[model samples]
Target chain A: MIPLSWYLILAAGLFCIGLFVVLTKKSAIGILIGIELMLNAVNINLAAFWHYYTQLNPSQTPLNGMVFLAIVFIVAAAETAVGLALIISAYRRRNTSVAGEMDLLKG
Target chain B: MTAMQIIFLIVAAVTLGGALMIATSRRMMHTVLWLVLTLMGVAVLFALLQANFFSVVQVLVYIGAIAILILFGVMLTRRSMVDAGESLVHKNWWVVAVVIALLFAAIVISIQPWGAAHTPLVELMEFKEPISDLGEALVDPAAYLIPFEVSSVLLLAVMVAAIYIAVDRKGGKS
Candidate 1:
């Protein structure tokens, strides 16, 4: 059997990579990509924890972990939609996608 | 060394490597492609964990739907951002690297209890069909009915907001 820690470690690594991407990338879409990666990491963690804990109390319904992940998936999707819409609107107003150049509301 | 470990390693490599490429790729389209690959690996990982339903959801919602939306966002959004700078901004790479490294260490250290390698894996004894139960639970007033309804409302609100923001007006370009 594969150890649950492996999944956790992988998720953590992926999360760090997402953080790096979000911090270093200049484009709004790239930041969105990083957010997606981070969300994936969270799902991995939730699934791993669920799988690990349900072993102890197999009688209880294992719906909670999956439900949490499912809800997160839905929220992440909605967040992406709104984020992309905002990014596109900003692009329309500014004519550029560079993160540094978006200084209209900075003041 | 086992089949499961090998599969996990492969998925991890694909996911992490694709994420790295997405971070460093200069072109937006390439980043999207890498994102797709990473998402696919995550789906496979979900399947390996025996959450086949969520694996399907990951493919359908993430790869099929969300990816296309991201592509549309990229295509529709900057028509000509030529000097948009490098995807991996060199000026802040060192700081970001340090931060990510510290964050990764913290997470790994914190997740030790639930996922230590010594913990043995046991088969799920009950609940033949978790997917059906999930569906039932969504509507079951004693379970997650409130969250289910709330999420639907949230999705509706988000859809309306997205449409509102993405639409163009007669003289709103400025």
Candidate 2:
């Protein structure tokens, strides 16, 4: 059987990768993708803790691991929609989608 | 190595490698593709964690739906794929260094408990009843009724918003 540490390590690694992507990627939608990755890493941690929680307290049943992840998923969808809408609107104004090219706010 | 260990390792590799490519890839479309692979690996890992319901939902909602919409958005907005670099700013190596540092700290903190002791795999298999239990809880007044209803409303709102944005205006030069 695989140990729980392995899952935690994986979550941490994925989280860091997502952070890197969000910081490095130039496109608006690409940053959204990075946010999704970070969300997935959070979900992984939640699921892992759910397993551990259940084992430690067998009588109570699992409380809120998957539930938390589900909520995060919904929020991610909402964020993507709003983000893409903003991106589309921005793109309509500026003829390019490159992240670095957007400097309209800079006076 | 055991089958479980091997499976975990493979999923880990895919998730991490796909994430790396997603971050570094120059092409926007290619980045989305890598994200899909990464999501699939994450779903597999969820299954390994014995969260079968979560695993299936991850595949259905994330892979089947959100990924498609994202790709659609990319296709609709971005210009034709150009090999020429289009990035606004060069990546800061310091960010990666910080991430690595944080990762190492997290691993160190997590190792104390995770490495100390472990329950056998059979015990974990028995707790698999959470799937059905979770379903029952979702509708139970004492359980997750509020959050469940809220999520449904949230999803509905997202659907309406996406449709409106996707169809409201078109042919704008960008």
Query: What is the two-chain DockQ of model 1?
Result: 0.70
Q: Write the per-residue lDDT of candidate 1 for residues B20-133, one digit (tens) a residue.
A: 898788788888999999999999988887788899999999999899999988888645555544443557788889988988888777777653555755446554747888
Off by over 4 Å in 2: A105-107, B80-91, B98-132, B163-174
lDDT of 2 by residue, A1-107 (tens): 77666777788889888877777776778888989999999899888877777767777777587688778888987888777776766666665556666788731
Give every candidate's TM-score on chain A: 0.95, 0.89
Evaluate all candidate structures by whole-model CA lDDT and list the values in order.
0.84, 0.78
Candidate 2 vs. true structure, TM-score = 0.85
Backbone clashes for every candidate come to 0, 1
Provide chain B's TM-score, model 1.
0.87
lDDT of 2 at B30: 88
RMSD of each: 2.3, 3.2
lDDT of 1: 0.84
Winning model by lDDT: 1
Worst lDDT run of 10 residues, candidate 2 chain B, spans B80-89
